[model samples]
Target: MTQMRFGQGTNRITGTVVMDRRTKCLVKRIQPGQIAVIDHPDLDEVAAEELVENRVRAVINAASSISGVYPARGAAYLIRSGIPVVDRAGADIFCRLQEGDRIWLDHDRVGKVGESQAVVRGERLSAQTVWEKIHQTQSHFNQTVVAFMENTLHYAVSEKRWFMRPLAVPGMYTQLKGKQVVVVVRGTGYKEDLAAIYHFIKAERPVLIGVDGGADALLQCGWKPDVIVGDMDSVSDEALCSGAELVVHAYPNGDAPGLERVEKLGLAAHILPGMGTSEDVALLLADQEGAERIIAVGTHSHIIDFLEKGRNGMASTLLTRIKVGGKLVDVSGIRHFYPPKTERRRKAPLWAAVFSAPMAVAALPGSFTIDDSWLRMVWLSLRLWYFP
Candidate 1:
């Protein structure tokens, strides 16, 4: 095993190095006090949140954390979380350092312990620098918007069927006809929004759909998805075995890579080939199932959400919105509107039970009848117990 060195300075951290070119994949392998080596450029907020949750000792980036193309609040999140981040450390670090190799990440350099030569040297990211970069990038954000719009229109023209016609979605066991369906995606503020709508979910009993890793998110919240739909790359084996109806989102050519993963796990899944993204397919599936209303949590709707996913074109999502318009409500809107409906519906049953209880007692035989004062007392007791 490789040995690590611990120094006295606050700016130095020594730990085992875990390297992956994919930020999300690396996050799964990393542990607390381990050094994460990743090649993610323009790291988004979701990735940063995972890194912070894992409590990695430090992050060494082969690519620039923020390319100034967009706000890319990931680096800012890391810095704010007090996790040291070394940016633009060069791709050579991957070739030079092996996984599980112990290394020392100093304020300015990273290298194997007891070595005088540094393997990767890069600038440490500070909150001030991140804030400044974001401010500078925001001023030029119009260019990004223009480019995104162009790409969206270009792809929208090619993929207009998704918006124009009804999707041929596979039959699902979960009945959604005239029922509320909540489609969950692993996007910004998903956790917060899910938590905020917890009462609504319990009260309304909506069909829950998870898109890829969104299944894991739902599981984390003590809820099992009624349907899990996506590429199946990010979801865990346990989630695959979760008994939810699996719907693999395939390419336009009917190539379903996620199906193999499901089969390997000895699980059956329905293949749904579509033109748009997995989330788009999810919404279309709900609509096809005759869902009365679709509540979306953590689904990206904004241009920045698409750009952060490195998607310049949101043709699929744009078309999906057009197709599901007036039926889909975002989490924010749900939080505002759903509670009243939930409360109203919840109270109706309680009120019915309350009124029916007295009627039920009154329907008893005359021999079982009690004084008016006793009956009033019983009603009062029932009211307190049921309403409280």
Candidate 2:
């Protein structure tokens, strides 16, 4: 670490800057000790987690990390992780600087090397300030919920027809009748959730449906998708060619945004024209196609999640859940339901163990009764002798 002469009581961070308007895309290229310049407002938790993982020197955001629209956890997460954040730095800073430009950021002042004046300025966010904002956001939760409900009701009246009016369920090359389906979405807590259900996936061999980039998540877990469904965005080319049946999501008007991408790869995809999120679409596909049960991984189901997604409402998710009914199961908190695997021991009754051994005398059936603890001790001694 380099120590520069600062005007006392301020730390100066010296590093090359990596700028991107999209934080999610920016995280893929950012490395440790380099500053990140992002334009994402109300940054989501997933983006924040990635930034914390990258060990960035500092974050200079063009937009407000917390807009107070809802209780966003991004700025707080980064701040709590001990990464300094400069919030609301004007967008013009991007025009003044280029990627890989070595710069110094001290408190709210940011500038190039040897520059007499600071090139751009912003408010350095503190844990206390953001937490106070978060508290206020929570206090006004009812207002946000009411607004979200009104928005949802408005859209629900228009979208209910699409969800309830019989969506055309296309024939899948992979049969779903009476079979279990696992719909994987690369949302928050997805990795931990996926790890929790690994045994179920291995044992049941349920059909895997990856929604967009979730296909990449499945591949990372060493499992290939049986059917990949989304608007063809966010999913990588490698996952597209992983032999999974492609199902492209199109708008209700039949405009397929991802069709050209699929065509370019010479891949034939089944068009599932529907109105809803890709996660909702995947759920409906599994249900309408006769999947016995649909296990959802990383699907957004919480109010906080909808807020982070910048959604005023989730009419699609709500309607889809109503239609799909109770067969949908989420993998969140599954670790509590299905605990981690541990070692097991095999043992029989002491009478059985003794009789099995040659030249071993067993007590008469009526003479003595062997207790569980005694049987366990005998088994442990024998196991130690053999296993050792």
Best by TM-score: 1
lDDT (10s digit) by residue, model 2, range 242-333: 99999999998889989899999989998888988889999998998899999999898877778777788989999999999999988865
Candidate 1 lDDT: 0.84
What C-alpha root-mean-square deviation, in Å, does candidate 2 show against the real structure? 7.3
Backbone clashes counted, model 2? 0
Residues 101-201, candidate 1, lDDT per residue (tens digit)? 99987777998988867897988888888888899999998998999899999998988864677666777778989999999998986876787677667
Candidates in order, TM-scores: namely: 0.84, 0.81
Report, for every candidate in turn, its global Cα lDDT versus the true structure.
0.84, 0.82
lDDT of 1 at 131: 89
